[model samples]
Target: MTDETRTSALQILRTLVGSPTADFHEGQYEAISSLVDGHSRALVVQRTGWGKSAVYFVATLLLRQRGGGPTVLVSPLLALMRDQISAAERAGVRAVAINSTNAHEWGDVVAALERDEVDVLLVSPERLNNPTFREQQLPALVARMGLLVVDEAHCISDWGHDFRPDYRRLRDLIAQMPSGVPVLATTATANSRVVADIAEQLGGAEVVTIRGPLARASLRLGVLRLPDSKTRLGWLLSHLGDLPGSGIIYTLTVSAAEDTARLLRDAGHAVRAYTGQTDTGEREESEGMLKRNEVKALVATSALGMGFDKPDLGFVVHLGAPSSPVAYYQQVGRAGRATENADVLLLPGTEDRDIWQYFATASMPDQARAERILSALERERPTSTPALEALVDIRRTPLELLLKVLDVDGAVRRVQGGWVATGEPWTYDAERYSRIAAERVAEQQHMIEYETTTSCRMEFLQRTLDDETAAPCGRCDNCAGAWYPTAIAADAAASAASSLDRVGVAIEPRAQWPTGADRLGLPVKGRIAAAERPLEGRALARLTDLGWGGTLRELFAPGSPDAPASAALIAACVRVLAGWGWKERPAAIVTMPSRRHPQLIESVAAGLSQAGRLPHLGSLEYLKGGPEGEPGGNSAYRLAGVWGRIGVPDALADDLAGLAATKPDSPILLIDDLVDSRWTITVASRALRQSGAAGVLPFALAVVR
Candidate 1:
């Protein structure tokens, strides 16, 4: 049986790679043999480009040839699914994918499955929870599945760097599989903890764990400490061209990615920004461009991580270090997959910790908020997320995440309409959460150590991942004495400085009232009235911007003193106004009464008014100490908190009326210290417009993205 399987697998492997001499890597054949011959569950923790996909594809065709059922592959990303399907086709296996993007083709896929034409079926973890697919298809698939494959399986472990709530549902799926059905889970990023967790979840002591050394022989690792974002950009400007081939330049935030991409393009480099905010079609196009080496590099955030297969990628450069060394290893593993040499460089920034903290907390479920969500859904009927938001204080993103966690915990169940409490009596695992948090802190410290370590960088990363065979590679900067250039060209430094100095971000006005406002007992609904809407406004910078973000973060940090704007900030605000390109100058300036930063808001209004030579019309009256709630709530709740809480004073009303009579086309500039929900600005603008202002132009010092 083993010899026959080997011959068959080698044939498929050669066909898959288009090479007659192609054969299995050291552990690939073992993984396949365990599944096909032993019919046992297996976990393959290998580096990227190790042909983990090949194990499953080869096993799948062999199983089907023996009259077994098709393989069900749970993949993570659309790009990955596309690549897998193409590879399966090369091996003469019919593959189909069911994901959000290709819902229209799901019926065709189902038809093909029924006809026994599909040898492999790929679906995302989220698809396992889809109402129709879960109820209508999963049970039947589980009954007949020849081999169950979980790609990027580290996501199933909470301790993993990129854990997904949806992936935890795999435990239920695994439990439901028919007895003797072989299972295979594969990942390129998993430390010892993650591997143990995944192995236990896959099937406990019966599972065969296969792990290889986590080191890339072709990767030359290095770290270059840069003082600020401008200097980092200068280094890239000076040295990007000198790197190998088309690669990735990773940033910590969306704004930074876009900013870096723009700067690189301005410097005549062929590059584009890829982030979560990028359109789906454009993301596909960008991936294609990068794979074909049509561009020099892609400026991207972590959204570009995992399942992006680019053999011979040449290099991977981090504009800011990731929070954990494991994550760094996973990202850098993307390079040198099938090449003799690839460059992996890290440019650690001062703001990296802040960014890491923000993301780390964003993923953890808050105990209080989770309890509130459960309490809101304890009623008899199913409640949609928006309706639940009206009843609870949590924002949409976090609220949805909490719901998924509860769903996985068996405390809540999603139905056709929305979600319902399962009455399963769930308890928050505070101890476990605390331990995970502590582990995260330790991992962050390890990442810092990795940046400053005098020891071998590659070996340090391997040890962080708990690779037993970790040893010095004699290749990284620390071991080989800086294989990368460190000098920044004078012209490149000037260009980077100029790019950072350029400021002004447009604040798009909120055009529509958030849905479920009526549930919150708010009168407003549907599109905001055109006349009441504020004109497109301007901000000095986004709170996430690579340039001004650090200063703004410090200024608005909790417990920070609320003082008047600094001379430099005031000047930056003036620069924003000068470059605004408004249709007409403002007739007067109106300030939003601030609860925390009254002095700051007033000073910015005064400074801009003085600079523009416009009359300062005083501040709007706060009916109830300004808006009720704090920052970071959903739009409906945020608007509800602000509605009827701001009023146009009689004096300011008369002043605006007088200005409207004299300068009918001119708008009243409304200034605020910060904009988060934008509901405050919308409400304030409506009040000013109702009080006889020709129009309102909203302005803010910074925007919280």
Candidate 2:
């Protein structure tokens, strides 16, 4: 590199960080120089807050100064893109991003790109597959692209902790880029296998990798094995204020995140819940609040994991262990980035493995389901996801994932309207998928060992990531004795127990029939008739709740004895009814015919009937031997399977008619053991309402979340 090039890069770095004395970290300058001067692909695998972004930003400015075209950067999340845009402004570089949230600004962004006004253009990997963008904007951008940057590059490798199928599209993007265009892939968490995989994808034997030690000296790690969820909540309620500065508290599920936030706020702590379910505007607001220390913490799920940049974050506490040590390391790495010391604690629960197992297999495609989808698309026409759901029973999420995998493998193509087959012969790679599943199991076991290991926690995590610089940090709880309090105040424990003991979740009735029901030979379409709709109902609790969730999971677990509702559960059902606050009391009780848990449903209905003095009406008869489809399917398929399968029996219909004549305003309480898709409740409630009941109030023991 020439002296002038080095001098200019250093100046840009100082301006980017707003520090006159700021210089490159150990490998930052080398990575930048390789990309800018050598014009070659480079991969930087370093710990979090190690200035990985600096390499790309500096390289971008240099390439632009040499009269190169705008740099194209592929980032994973909107939060990350927002942060990078702000950093680019600090360095006097114009950065624009095109994502789902900013459809209104695409025209201006494209104009700016055409005018050669953009310095860096940030886009998500998913955007690469957009029919319009790929056909209209991508070709021009690739033709003159000066540099390409892939942030969170670990996601590209299937062996990585968080593998995303969209990232696999980057291989084709790289192959189509002009030959001299420098490419940089950066990540904070990657073991040897993932690193090699990403490097091979970038360009085997041609991609230069600059790796550094994965240890974060500023983080003090520890683990606390709590007995149960209640105690964990109590610990937080008692000691959250004791953690140094505003930080994050991670949970395994969205319900847990919201529940924890509520309990902590009731204890007078300023906190907010963040999850994938949170509105985009609210998520952005919460991110700002955490960055400015306006709130004590953001109770969040993995949705808040990547692309969030908080330099002085004080601590991170996990309510449950993540499934893998690599994932845990990435989450904890968020803390102590630019501070002298930040506390990291894990309060693992006994149910952690159960939660892990629930999510572990969700991403893998099923061979039978894949073949069914392919066969459906063989008709040579476009089929939207909802329409396709009527043809095949896969749920929306896993179906989308399968389509992306098929798209990458050349088996199918997602066009403007929907998806179409490529007529390419595709075989299920059972060997590869099974190996990946086995790796996941191994990772879960390692996470358990991490929670109980007597060795240094930081060292254990570093070694888990295959860092050669792993050693005792001498600052973790195991190394220097526990730095956090273990005792939970009696009052705090009582408060937590009370919160957990509380039950009742509102069951919002489905307002509209799913689109494409006609494709399944059902006449339903558009908005459901208001008169046929069930009144707002209640469930004892969500299957994912921290408190009642555990009990419900055990009661409804696969292979569990199909017995009557226990006394405690019956009492809980009464509590839910007591707090329902319905405008008018239910005039009678009815149960949905259940194939799996008839005893449980009947017992609950009978108990509620005896307690409330309401007559128990017979269950709705199953017309076709109960609902056909199993649990866990898309709305369209679920609704189709149960559409006409439930009918009001002759005796039940007559009794409801008589009750309606006596009390025209009262509703019939319909009970069930569990509510998954809510289609069964909808179908049954419509039958009751049509059979003379003024309204139907659906009640369930648990609602699947």
lDDT of 2 at 636: 86
C-alpha lDDT values of all predictions: 0.90, 0.91
Candidate 2 Cα outliers beyond 4 Å, as residue runs = 160-163, 378-380
Candidate 2 displacement at residue 661 in angstroms: 1.8
The C-alpha TM-scores of every prediction are: 0.98, 0.98
For 1-705, candidate 1 gives per-residue lDDT tens digits of 468778988999999888999989989989999999899999999999889989999999888988899999999888888888888888888999999998899999999998989899999987899888999998888888999999989889875523578999998999998899999999988888989999999989999999998889999999999899889999999999999998999998999999999999999999999998999899999999999999999999988888788898999999999989878887888888899999999999999898889888988988999888888895479998888887888888889889999998899988888999988888999997888889899989999999999999999998999998999999999999999888999999999988987789999999999888888899888999999999999989998998887789998988999999899889988999989999988888999888889888988887888889988989998896667878758888899899999999899988988888888889999998889889999999999999988888899888998
User: Model 2, range 597-691, lDDT digits (tens) per residue?
Assistant: 98999998889989999899888898977788787588888898898889998999899889988999999999988888888899899999999
lDDT of 2: 0.91
User: In model 1, where is the ten-residue run with the lowest total lDDT?
Assistant: 155-164
